[model samples]
Target: MMRRAAFALLAAALLGPLPALAQDAPLRIEITEGVVRPMPVALRFEDAGGAGELLGDITAVIADDLNGTGLFEMTEPESSPATGFDRTVDYIAWKATGTEALVTGQVALEGDSVMLRFRLFDVFAGQPLGDGMQFVSPREGWRRAAHKIADQIYARITGETPYFDSRIAFIGESGPATERVKRVGVMDYDGAGVKWLTSKDDLVLSPRFSPDGQTVLYTSFASGVPQIMSLDVETVTSTALTRDPRAMSFAPRFSPDGKWIAFSRESSGNTDIWIMEVANPSFAKPITLGPAIDTAPSWSPDGRHIVFESDRSGSSQLYVMRADGSEPTRISFGDGGGSYGEPAWSPRGDRIAFTRQTKAGSSIGVMRPDGSGEQLLSEGGRDSGPSWAPNGRVLIFTRLTADDEVPQLHSVDITGRNMRPVALNDAASDPAWGPLLP
Candidate 1:
């Protein structure tokens, strides 16, 4: 039972108390710029399943995950001589092919279960950095096994926990805006095995997972007006966080420890930031007070401070404050008037990602905690709602087509490479990325 606390000072200062605008217009963003190229690497399938092609499928999946990061350019396995897990003795050979790193592995089929053994080596160092381990799983679960292996390899090489085996909970959309149908959907980090946690008949938004990935908090208009609610992912049972009939609450995010929920609450025409104990929702407290609009509160990794979007400066700007709701500081100073919103603090706690709207268009960008070194990563069309992958090097956000007819979930490397849509069978939006699965 982790105790989660919500920090709401920043939100209260911004948007003074106001009701949500009844605009049917879709949110828009622009990908104004990006980085130049991607990194390169070489990967050879370890002959784990002997000389059979069974191992090829396993290695291919692993390669996909690495390549998908846009941080690695995978070398064709056919061009390499390191065919077996134990036969990978030629470091110079792979180095000659311009590969900075190499991955080799083996797979064994034991009854209905399979064991995969893999190793990640630095081609430049000419040595393995970590011990090779074997993963055992049912034969039907090979795909997930491959993801786990990729995660292990990524962590060993980058010193960051991999997000490959994680899951994303987002709103799946269907029907028209006047009578929209939105359901809470959860899927693997790679966009596979999508399962709807809530029926489409409900108007759900801002689906966020608990730190442990067992529960989700979202805003649902199912009860008529928008209200904050929590759902146990395992049981599919939901409980409303607030019962204010005239008040509309949105943008609920859990504290790092998962003991409290920080969200926006609108009551009697005033919207402010508030926190409630998950163990006792009745224990609600307001962290922000004002006549402005303050929404979208994101907690710092240490739980000492919170970053949220507010219009206190006559425009939406990013702000940070102490968890107890004191000492507020504005963090954004870029082109204003277009409104900056949806500030998501990185799990790494080094930077914050946000959506910036200008007359040119809305763009996804990141800046230091003090609002320095702001860099716009994407442009053209709408690329709003940036959520950090568990590794903190990648972001998942909604990219709307030009006509605004289709909204898809796309991922981009922090360096601005491998910007592509996640493969899902349905339309999605307002994606909230979850932490890596343990």
Candidate 2:
């Protein structure tokens, strides 16, 4: 888990005792299909003490996060009856309005920090969904605290891992198409708190976050050639992981354990998959060597196998092999007459997302590890570079069209519904979703 070393944040029990209730089956919404009716949810957040504008901001973020998922519909807070954090929820009133879940919260401002406490309730069951918890953070970190609250509610209701409190690393592009300037940047998953990690003097591509989310591996042209580099997320410093002058390395990704790095290295004229130890980057070795051009290696969730793009069969396709470069098997058979590349293994270990380019256009699709059950999850115009969320229910990718002709980030559910562009000011590409925060 990734934690903010600079912020003084603490999570503790609520100040007052919470309600105790019946133990019935918890409410859950399994996301298996594309079409889903939004669940009716009522939210009422109170200002505990000295929390004026902060309360509204926090409440808005929580509501937006929940409603944006397309699984939950929030009722107008001003229209709903008021409720206290310590008092019993009005189940009858909420149920009368067809509300299934009710969320109540309180916010207070301390000397230099703010305390946020919240809880969830099953309206029909007349029971508290979970215990109330409080989070204390500096005034500037109120958004982080709000994300935490939203994550808790999401997980408790959906029976899945939360991804609201996560960040994304991407390549920010600007300028004309003939000469564009690119830099590495990081921001909140919803495109807030943008921070640039590199200067625009050199080009950077394929920014991959480490398992711990503290470091980013990317290919840089600072040395006038493509070389793998690692950047510290906190300090904004970078170090070259591969300094070989004879070879060009790119598409770097960390293994599940964070002890090894899988990337593509091209020397002379052939490109192959390579692995290097984080502790000993000076000693790097090739994992796949053949006449075909093999690149863009992605590791399975268990770190036992790797899926990459290869052209050994005379066309670009996806292949899976052991982590040690043995027992190679082709996963994509080109049933659509196009090509595939940039394979990303889902965190759930159930699917592999990839970029499929057919004669019609380009689309983002996914398939089982063995290449069965292939499903295209996007319109075939110009969609590529699919990166799975931490929960594997949604994917973020880049899209381009002739109307705009600029690359931008967009997110879509695995079922190909609710596809929307990410709220970003500049042209962005090569998005990499990090893990949830600690």
Candidate 3:
């Protein structure tokens, strides 16, 4: 009996923490490849308290979030087998519709507070798939609550990090093309609650958010000279990094730790990459030197390497250098004779996405960190400036129908599928995706 007790204790320790439901195993789907046939799912969201006016919209947001990933085909609630949030789930009936998964939930109002509960189930297996959860918040946090729910579902199903609770800082374009007004604007990942951070009084470009999303780094021509500036997103206040009248600085991005920023500076007809500690811009130092123009520097997630585009090879190409500016190596070899630029390293440190400009057209592509597995994930007139979602499974970039047409934001899966324009105001460029919100 002593040996049995010891064996039981060892087994418990080895199993780690068992989930809320012991019968269900964690979803172990490796999403490295594209799915030709999306798994079909049924979602039944019911309004628990007089069916509040916002319930439908909340549920719609959840469905849109899941469907946008291109991994699931949603079934209309009317045809779903499940009735409501706490119902006795009819899993067999759900399976009969050829649905692999079912989501059932309810939104309720209790004493001026919003309460939501939901569960995901494997229809064919007739069992709960993931741990059920709930979210409670103030009435005004409906959208945030919805996004959190989507994030939970996404993380649970794909076993990947969630990116729905994030924002985008980019240059917003308006007015006539010949005299367009560009300012910094931010919005939710789904393009809601857009807040312009800068007035159209001056031209601002390449607005990048700090790792923590409290501050923004951008370029402004308000002084009649292009200079890098920082803006407090919360306070709406701005400050120029330096008052030097001779040097031109722009295209600034923060390192993963938010301790430093990398940008491009031009002087005497030459441009090079530079890095500065965030606390003291006066101590900035050049990272890449010499005669070739190098700009658009992005730091690897671990902060040990920097990837940027340079003209050192007589044509634009992607190159990687150590954070200390050592052993720079070219990584971009586009379809024989194409040029490459706008390289963005993935937050997961798996692949790098960039703009590949060939004689055929400008498109978006991804390659391994060593420059292998080059797959062009887009086909169109003009696509450039790729930014990875927090999960690194999707990329957002600027897409144009033609050279003269307005550019819009479009997202494509890394597998070269689900290419679609994000619903946002057009004529925008230079997207900088921030980390997930707290």
Q: Which has the greatest TM-score? A: 2
Better of 1 and 3 by lDDT: 3
Where model 2 places Cα greater than 4 Å from the true spot, the runs are 1-35, 77-79
lDDT of 1 at 43: 59
Each candidate structure's TM-score, on Cα atoms with residue i matched to residue i, is 0.86, 0.91, 0.89
lDDT of 3 by residue, 308-346 (tens): 999999999999999988989999976677899988999
Candidate 3 Cα misplacement greater than 4 A, ranges: 1-35, 77-79, 110-112
Compared with the true structure, what per-residue lDDT tens digits does model 1 show for residues 1-438? 122111223333454433112222347899989955444666556554442565888888788888787666676654665445777558787777777777777787767888888777888889987888888888888888999988887787768778898899988887776776889999988888898988877788999988899999999998898998899888989989888888888899999999988999998888889998999998988898998888899999999889998888898889998887798899998854567889999999988999988887778989988889888889745779999887788899988778746778998877776789898988899898887876
Cα lDDT of candidate 2 equals 0.90
For each candidate, what is the lDDT?
Answer: 0.82, 0.90, 0.86
Give per-candidate clash totals: 24, 0, 0
